[model samples]
Every structure is written in C-alpha cells, then in structure tokens.
Target: MDRQDAESAVRVLSGYPTEEEVAALIAVLAVVGQAARAAPGPEAAGARPGRIPAAAFAAGYQSPTSWQAS
Candidate 1:
C-alpha cells in the first residue's frame, strides 16, 4: 500500500481543525454507517404490488385493493 494511504484515511484541504473536531466527525460517521448497515434496506420498504392481468381474473384470481389505501 502507498505510504499516505497506510498512514491516514483523512486529508486536510483547508484550515487546520483541532483533534477533538476530527474525533467528533469520525464518531458521527461511524454511528451513521452502523445504522445504515443494520437497516432492512430499500427493498424491504413494502410489498411490490401490481395490477392483476385480465386473464388472471377470468381464471378466478381475487383482486387486491384494500392494502393500497392510505
């Protein structure tokens, strides 16, 4: 690995910030990262409901509607 990458993961682009400020930022980032990983994700938002085809109805498939109501 490159010397810079191995030494540090953060870089200063502008004014120098105190060590406490960097520590706080890193803590917040770590909490948010953990929350995101534990989440059920976008796919778990809800059921992927879709309209039943006319042919399915002809074959006696029950329609779905009650769940769509807000």
Candidate 2:
C-alpha cells in the first residue's frame, strides 16, 4: 500500500504514536507482508507422514524384536 493508505489506517487505531514509532511499525509491516508473499501456503506445508515400505518386512527380512526374559 502507498503512504496515503498507511497514514489513513494508522489514524483509525487508538493511541497517539510519534512519527518515528509509526515509521517503525510500517517498516515491520512491510517486512511481514513481503515474507507472507514469499512463504509457501499452508496446504503445501501439510505433508502426509511417511510409512515404512512393504519390502521392509518381506521374506527373509529380520525385523528387530524386543528381547525376551522368559
């Protein structure tokens, strides 16, 4: 957004922040906006968990078993 939009939005929020504070807030907001655009979407991040392949338990396979005390 342009300077005008930023200024107008700031006017709506409570408190009377100084010019420096406003500038800092805008700078942080700009970084966050940029990061959000660059980052991957939620769907892309929700990957399914992987399971062991069937071959892992195929014939002659010796899967580790817990030690028995009996």
* Top of the candidates by TM-score: 2
lDDT for 47 (candidate 1): 35
Stretches of model 1 off by over 4 angstroms after superposition: 1-15, 46-70
As for candidate 2, its clashing pairs are: none
Local distance difference test, candidate 2: 0.68
Encode model 2's per-residue lDDT on 1-70: one tens digit a residue.
9997677567747566668778978899999999999998644756434644455557555544623432
User: Model-by-model lDDT, in order?
Assistant: 0.64, 0.68
What tens-digit string does per-residue lDDT give for candidate 1 at 1-70?
A: 6976433434433445557657866898999999999988644754344645566679976645644663
Q: After superposing candidate 2 on the true structure, give the runs of residues whose Cα lies further than 4 Å from its correct spot.
A: 1-14, 45-70
Q: Give the root-mean-square deviation of each candidate in angstroms.
A: 14.9, 13.7
TM-scores for all candidates: the values are: 0.40, 0.41
Q: List the residue pairs that clash in candidate 1.
A: none
lDDT of 1: 0.64
